[model samples]
Target: DIDRKHIHIVSVRVDETGKKISDSFEKKRSDAIRKELEKKYSLLPAEKQRQPENLPLKRVDYKAGDVKKQVSNVAKVVMKSYRFQSLNEYRAVLSIYGVTVEEVKGEVRGKAYNGLVYSALDRKGEKVGNPFKASLIGKTAGYDALQKRIAFSKQSMKEKAVYNRSRNIISTLLANKPDRKVFEKELAKNGISVLFRENDDKRIYGVTFIDHQEKTVFNGSRLGKEFSANVFHELFNRNGRQDSSGIDYEKQFHINNQDYQPEQESTAEAIAGIFSMEQHGDDYEELAFTNRMKRRKKKRKGFGL
Candidate 1:
């Protein structure tokens, strides 16, 4: 035998799918492996002839627990990096990350189609799954759970935008630390109302903001603790006199006109102004030079006379 390796005869039978293989399949498989081993040997140096690739067994199996942990780690990374507003969005993003999802269609436990399964590719392009069930991952990872998260995310996004806008207005109006009455007026002008919680001693304990433009109610702590009642009192003080909780209006009016509000000017407008100034300066210099030339000509005429 050219290859001095011991070979054992194993059972030869039809596969589970009723497919039959002859002795040629095993011979071909052996030849392919022999060529691979020879190529690996040719590439190795003489000093390291006993490499692990030359061992009888080369492939190793990955444990099921390790595979599950890898999948869950990928899921956690995706969840942190992206906020998927819908299940389709989640699937699309997951596909980009080498994970594929399939919907389990049919009734389960007397319900309609309400399950999902996922698979991932390993390093060798082999599919591996400790297949992740939707319900098993967590409550926020299921089909209906994603729908609820989408709704909440949309609302939260809207609230954040309104909060930023309101904060900008507050900063602009209170740049000089105006009194409580003026501060309230400025907020009302921007279609925002502030509610203060009072204790039994008529002292303010907390604050909440009601934005008419966004139709959302947010407590001071939700925006941040810095926006709470104590901070408001500090902002509204004037000349050692402070009154934080003084506004009393049954019905709040909407800021119908945008003229009362101020927004940041666009960069294009500022750039145009700069160019305009430079153009005016150049025109003035040219006019001054022309006037000097005229005066020089008149002086030459007088000297010649």
Candidate 2:
């Protein structure tokens, strides 16, 4: 297993305009600099020098973390900026970054299952970063998470249609600028639930919206840039401001009038499933408690007519 906590520094070059040059461009520049250094180092007295050979000419083995950082930098810039719904889609994107995702055998729940690992090739077509787990590199790129993220696309033919319809419903509802609470409630009526992801700082970073009726899940960014966490936070903040001014934000928001029978109370379970998908192993109880409370409602007795 690789230790993910180690941080590594990467060398980069900036042009005269202060823009970071491409990796290939920077490598060419570094090669030129290396030749100059070698010339100067060769002229030094043998007794006064650390080594007779120039330091730049010495073979350098990059640390494991350094390799991880290199692969991740490419993955982040090329793979993450767009919506990818499946491992195939993810693999395709990785290829563009000069990397490939591979399936390997791994133990899950004490039984062996197919898992994902990654590899990249050098200019000479020599493979590097041998069989590193996707999770070891990043959470969102993990095998389990990718399965959940693209679960909708993997649905059966009939259910996949339902999933697409739910997507349309969610897309329309989000366009109305409903706050987080309102969005969840509204989507839940159609058997969809939104799962918001936060970091240690409690700032929203990502979201997955799951449709229980269709048995499918989708990343919010997969829907559109407007549906990302930042836009969701914006809607939430606007709702708070609107509520303080005594404005009925819900009333102003457009929702179809047709009586859509609300689905059964599956929101809590669905959200919990999302937590499981995210691999929050130690925080399961915490996530379950929070989601349970959010879905719980107080009972009110009604007068007999």
Candidate 3:
């Protein structure tokens, strides 16, 4: 999270003459100045180190059979809730994130296996969603490696999509200077910022536009598999409970024989089901309320109107 008010903006301008300065005698002068500044900064005292706060961590141990059973249970619950016409739709969404499903088998002929009937593997051949198989991946070096690979793959895909869209917009804008200015102005009006521009060589490079006051609303780190499951559970299982005062609160749906409270149940299940799931506990609602109050206070404090 960033403090939007503390953001600083720096602007750099480059023109034909400025470019010539870099190519000529100014290069040596700039390099010497940079070295001098670096030497001066190196003599400064080190900053005080802050003590690291310890976080609670837990390890889950389950076998392949246990994972199979959990997946089957979760699948059954999802199917019952969702109005999917076919199993294909369910499988398709899972496959989008490179999840592979396989059926478990019995060693004895004609006898059914009590263990996991299906297992899921990620793109890196490591178990992703299946808790039973996750232990294997974690024990090996595959878990961390696969996670990084998947994250990078997804980010690359998103960047490519954004780049393609930007290219089309840029091409359209280049048709006319007045239209280009209009496009930039429209983007500014909407607070849709950019961060790069072209140089005299026609090569697009360097930061162009940045929204100093805009705090990033969502972080990819918070949208991992566990978070997805929590969101899914909240959206699907939980019903909005209306209080006497007419305020609605999200309540988790519970089945028979569960000891966890609504929010705890959903969060625990989500954590147990997904890989790298962090325990956010029941603080989401409280945090939201606190943030709302803070925003209200800031609004009152900063804006007299």
Clashing pairs in 1: none
Per-residue lDDT of 13-84 in model 1, one digit per residue for the tens?
A: 787787885667786786677678778887544235443321121111234345444444444444433444
Clashes of 1: 0
**Which number leads on TM-score?**
2
Ranking by lDDT: 2, 1, 3
Please state every model's RMSD to the true fold in angstroms: 28.4, 22.0, 29.0
Report, for every candidate in turn, its global Cα lDDT versus the true structure. Answer: 0.48, 0.49, 0.31
Q: Select the stronger candidate by lDDT from 1 and 2.
A: 2
TM-score of each: 0.30, 0.33, 0.21
Which residue runs of candidate 1 sit more than 4 Å off their true CA positions? 1-155, 237-254, 257-305
Off by over 4 Å in 3: 1-66, 69-133, 137-143, 160-293
Q: How many residue pairs clash in each candidate?
A: 0, 0, 1
* Ranking 1 against 2 by TM-score, winner: 2
Top candidate (lDDT)? 2
